[model samples]
Target: MRVTRSLTIKQMAMVSTVTLIIVSLFILLQLFHFVQQRRLDYAQQMESVALTIRQPLSEAVLKADIPLVERLLATLKLSGVIARADIVLPDNIHALHNEFILEKPVPALVSHLFELPVSIRIPLYSPERAMRGPLALLVLQADSARIYQFIRVTVATMLIAYLLLALMLTVAISWCINRLVIRPVRHLALALKTLAPEDLIAHQLPLLVGHRDDELGQLIMAYNHNQQTLGSIYNEMYCKASGFALPSLPNEALFLALIEQHSKSVENAAPLAVIVLRVETLQETHTLVTDDQRNILLITLVNRIRDCIDASCVLAQINHSDFALLITRDSHIFRTMRLARKMTRKLTQPVTLGQFQLHPETSMGISLHEKETPHAKELLNRASSAMMSAHYHGKNQINVFRTGNGDG
Candidate 1:
């Protein structure tokens, strides 16, 4: 799996949310279990205390002695289990009551005391009153310390667990996603970077993720399909738009596209090579040669030059005497000047079309395509400027485009 250099913010957020949810659920479960265990313990303790008070509470009710009942309630409270105790009479009278039974045994309580869920226990007593009277209702309450302790410990454990889980999840998800999504994308980006605008061929992207019925997979597939389609369209357009029979050189559209492609390629990438050639001393040769002879000479010269062009080369006539050549990066750009020299030398040889010596002089200029200006016209201008510079400097010379080397 590939890894991306960086994760998009949205992907990071999604991973974070998933991790947070898992951690939150774990914490919630822990807290709930603690609360449940705490409640069970408190219930057991309350039941025992209620049962313990049964006999004494019944005896106190039979005698209706408020003082004894108070003493018993105080002693029970001193045990520190119950928070509040109340013993009522058979007449439903508010009798002996010990309300201090509800306060905490410990002096320090957590500030969020009210946050703890409280449980209440009400005790019903049947006082024997000639076997005819209804029993009194007794009520008891106490701090849920056992339950609270469980909750406290549970919350602490859960908080720690949540923190640890969150950390683990963050690291895991970032790595997983980086491998799954980012890595593949980075690989694709590198491939795209390799693509030159001149590269009409389509490239296949790598499978970053194992094929899954997931959204990311679908997106990758769609993008790859689109690239193929676009590549096809580009090839068709270029084929129909850049080449034709050598004589006419097709229409302006074809020529312009050739220029644009070279220009765009230069802008997107490193410098390319350009050559400008103008027929010098053509008029002098044509003075003795007829119009038909001149036409044939120009046509023959263009054909000869075109023969030397490579696959990714463009040759176009800007005017009757000037032509432009665009080529991919060549190790020997100066070789083009040599080639032009050879062609001019061969063409300048005296031709006898019934006693006519047609000697043509050609001037050549070359320049590197760079990002500053990649337009075909701009490159052509530079080449033309260089050629003019060579022409004015000395006849029949080769020139290379350079900064401040304007045509004199």
Candidate 2:
């Protein structure tokens, strides 16, 4: 329920990691596709080179002209990639060529008369029947570095484009998350921190900005629900714990009010009872639990006592170990004594704390309203004196203060 800075850090980290993983997977898939495309293009380029030289060699074979074939092959060899070329004719006739007109037989597919742009093993098989007029065989060995350079350039371009796109997407996604999710949560956190423990009226909750069906919307709804629940609890606790002075059991503010009303009430003075209740051995309980746990136990005790009292009975926290109750009715003495006995009895039962159970004790003191009491200060001193006497006597006891007349 208490939103902390650590929660914000953890949420941001989770969202960022998810974004990174998604972007990485997309980039990897695109790179794989790009590599495959480049490889296929290279294969097609190599096939095109092999096909281009086919027509010229076939024409040379049709004419049965060796000199013309030799000149054509030599011209093609100027492409710096051709290694060998051959025109096989019907009846065992052959027109073979090379780059330098080598004296030895040419190797299997490395001809000296064909042109290619990159390193490739291309086997050119004549599409005609074996006994046909002409059959051309072309082989080429080109520079590999040139092909690799082209592929590198193309891949580099694609990668650059992909990187730009990825960066744009990352920015857009982070911005959206910051606006729709992170910003709202931050505002809610700020609102939570500034809230006073006494504030009762609920302020309007902020509305979610983006997709209603999404997780961020759900988070906003959950946060609002939790805030409302805590707000209600705080209001109830604040009102129950406000406006009384302990030991004397007077509202310091209301004492002025009583003074203003004293002239009218003096003609028929009503009895008043002030009860000062102390949780005994609270220091021992403090040693038994953490500060937070001690607060929980003490708050539990306060709520229990509050359930037994009415709204007119002003109650307030006096100290870490005590609470005060002031009743203004004519029957205040009887009601205060009865409620104190019931509350002290209830506290003697064991309370569960994790795996341990603790039994707490209470001591209470009662002081009656005196018509002759000079001020609020005197009333409080007498009540505190009675409470101290009860605590000094023993645990779980109630002592009442009396004037020298011993009437109260």
Tens digit per residue, CA lDDT, model 2, 61-156: 556677766776566555543444444434344446354323333333323212223244433333455543335444444443343454457557
Top TM-score prediction, candidate number: 1
Highest lDDT, which number? Answer: 1
lDDT of 1 at 396: 69
Model 1: per-residue lDDT, tens digit, 1-408?
464434665677777788888888877776666666655665567667667776776677667767777776666665455666766556667676676634544324442443443434444455544555445556666565645666667778778878887878787878888877777776777877877866635766655557545666776678788889998787667655654333555334555567677666556554567677788755566576777877777777777777667767777776667777777655155665666666556655554455665556778787766646656667767888888877777666778877665542
| TM-score for each model | 0.51, 0.41
Q: What is the C-alpha RMSD of each candidate to the true structure, in Å?
A: 14.0, 14.3
**Error at 165, model 2, angstroms:** 2.6
